[model samples]
Target: MNVQSNPVTASDTNARVLSYAEAIREAMAIAMQADPTVILMGEDIGVYGGAFQVTLDLIDRFGPERVMDTPISELGGAGVAVGAALTGLKPIFEFQFSDFAMLAMEQIVNQAAKLRYMLGGEAAVPVVFRMPSGSGTGAAAQHSQSIEAWFGHVPGLKVLQPSTPEDAKGMLLAALADPDPVMIFEHKLLYKTKGHVPEGSYLTPIGKALVRRTGSDLTIVAGSIMLHRALEAAEKLATDGINVEVIDLRSIRPIDRDTILTSVRKTGKLLVVYEGVKAYGVGAEISAMVAESDAFDYLDAPILRLGAADAPVPYNPDLERASVPQVDTIEAAARRLVRREV
Candidate 1:
């Protein structure tokens, strides 16, 4: 379907249909062109053009010096990025996959995050680390893990996950501008999906929630690919006289609590959905916030959480689908929370 979007005028009609990966590359291109200090460092990012080819053609434009490909060492490479950021360069590091970030947990969680505060604002690390996350591509147990909850627990660190093309561009720009370290968890499945993104420079403010859909009956909070799934479930639920509000908690850390509380107070019902395991995911955080806030009195039903099981992401396609929350899972959970029988 040809979707009508806000179009921006360019010098030529070279408006080629671009994927999410291309949108991200465009953001990097624009940022690099604007600032010489913004450099990319990661394994295969320079010559191999990244494991996902998201950094393709960047080396040719910026040359090998700025676009560097390091050895197969997450911890050492992350340390390099931290040192680079300390010495006045904005380094954008790419972990081949989200699971690899665990190898560099000390650099990210302790040193990079606590530098400014520990030194009384003497040292600042303006860095953006990109980690392709989630379990949709059959990457199995080791390569796939939704560990945003881990980063969100740390102070002075921003954790962002973009669910759309526009966000993919906007959030990256914002991450580069932050004085502290920002960890971006881009889901693997969203790479091929396309959406109309604005031309020229743009930035989506960090620590803000986006209300994707407006309604009065119920509010559904989600992030990453699950945000799109919740929006789909909202459309189907609408046909049955249920109006659902969809909130995309774009930034997991320093979450937009006001937006969430306002939505719950207005809608009176809440459903939190995500692809991460339910035990300690973003859903649990939001659920606890609502329970403790004044919004608790406004709840018409118990806050519901729909997420992956505690087990590892299965290799089998059927079990994989069953492992995480999908459209049907979201729909069923919403129905039960709203007291609607399917």
Candidate 2:
């Protein structure tokens, strides 16, 4: 295996687009190529080539030692990754599905997340935990939960949910270099969806939100799959003379409160959208932030929230569609907030 051949340095020229999974693979390749100390560890990541093939061709390039496949114990695999990270080896751990991360919560949130802080900043756990999150594959409730809120609540962990291919690659690269624990929530539906990603290595700083669309009527704060829906809704609302600004909260933890507040103050109205259940979801936190910030006084209307219903992700496509905030739901929510119609 030639690790030096797959360097991940960014070029000064144009950036080429890539798929979400390909972007992830690119980050892994670059990281391993850039630093020999980086290794991959997870279940089915070796000969099986990963459950979603995100680690495809990596084992062939780095061999079994660097691209090791472990038993199907999330706890054990995660713990091993943490121990490796503590010893100066950058271990990228893959959780087959976000739902399975629950089984290793103690290791992830308690151990990996707290190691540096507990050690008085003497020890750092530079591990990137990647998991396929969100619903769309009919994976049922057990396999289709958006658990970003759970980890975002933890103090020592950084939670990232990139909505585009560019960010998928950029964020992963940045997370790999972070000195603390980082959890990346990769949307399952976006794996095959193609987009233009930078051709070489780059980093999108964590904790900064991006304004996807600019407008003055209302502001929509969203993340993950819901970001796409918010953009679609903004376009439809534009025709009705409503100018809506869509903000993508790419970094859930250490969220960009300044950017969010600035947008809401200009728009005078706010609508927070997320894919998780309405109660205590990302939207709730965003809405509260706006209300507490100076942006609250500039609101022309109450800060509205639209989110998934508090129920299991249904197996039926129609039922599932209705359970979450789809484009139509987002459109309606935007229109209502803009006073377009009911």
Candidate 3:
């Protein structure tokens, strides 16, 4: 019954549930209304309503001038957005797919990430790159990939992967307000997932993680859709006398090391799960963070990571389902970690 999301305001007592995509669009609409400098640039976003239809009809309200669509050039579009941000306009650039962002690495990793520091804070690139990520929709390898780990490695770039609709909206608004460039990877399957979202503007802290569920036996860390799966697994494992703690790692780059360390210290067992490739993913980073910290002394068992198999996203539904950790797999991993260690 536990949903992983930040608490809403007192004024949001009557907050309504919105699909993750709708919440994102609402955030952009709010930002655009409040700040004339806010603009959106992406291919097929205007008339076509974006590749996933997340930007549907924004052009009708903001008009083509503000919600202008770009050509199928990720590098060129990203360059323009970065350039726009340099000149003081807030541009939210949406990549058609997370995979396409690699084509603009020079702009994202080299230019946008370093300009503020390289210019000695003389310029701020308040650009938000919205990427529809993950591989649940049968888009296959080319269109489906969870490569947040790639840019998460890039310094000076803030990377966020929100699991809930509330976070999806709040985090986007927060990124728009930040001076540094932020990348938000929206899992494709989460677009239709709904959750309560507060009316009006708000911000979810970028670098913090939320302890979704508390337990004393084990800690399961996950983000994006994986967070939801972790929560489900935790609930099921509770019936088997294996209580598992779950942490929603909202931000990938600036991980909430303190929360993770504290949980591992309490639980003494860690299971890191992600939708990315199993080897050298964010799970490894968390494992290393715990292993290198004082939390290592508290661990009753060796830390384990559960992520996608070492292969491209499969197009077949059943194979795709097997490619990544699911509720059953997560439950099994948690049970194994707890029973074997605790």
lDDT of 2 by residue, 1-342 (tens): 000111122323355657788989999999999999899998899888898999999998999999999899999999999999999899999999989999999999889988888999999999999989888889889988898998989999999998877788889989988988899999988887776676767898899888878899999998877888888888888998889898888999989999999998899988898887889988888889888888889998888888878899999998988888888888887878778343
Q: What digit string (tens of lDDT, one per residue) describes model 3 on residues 140-245?
A: 8898899999888988899999898888999999999898999999999999888888899999889989887889999999999999999888888888778888
Instruction: Point out the higher-scoring one by lDDT: 2 or 3.
Output: 3
**Model 1, which residues run further than 4 Å from truth?**
1-17, 340-342
Question: Which prediction has the highest lDDT against the true structure?
Answer: 3
Worst 10 residues of 1 by lDDT: 1-10
Residue 75 error for model 3, in Å? 0.4
Residue pairs clashing, model 2: 17-196, 17-197, 18-197
Task: Tell me the whole-model lDDT of each prediction, alpha carbons only.
Answer: 0.88, 0.86, 0.91
Model 1 earns a TM-score of: 0.95
TM-score of 2: 0.94
Q: Name the 10 consecutive residues with the lowest summed lDDT in model 3.
A: 1-10
lDDT (tens digit, per residue) of candidate 1 on 260-319: 999999999999998888998788899999999999999989889988899998899899
Pick the winner on TM-score between candidates 1 and 3.
3
In terms of TM-score, the best-performing candidate is 3
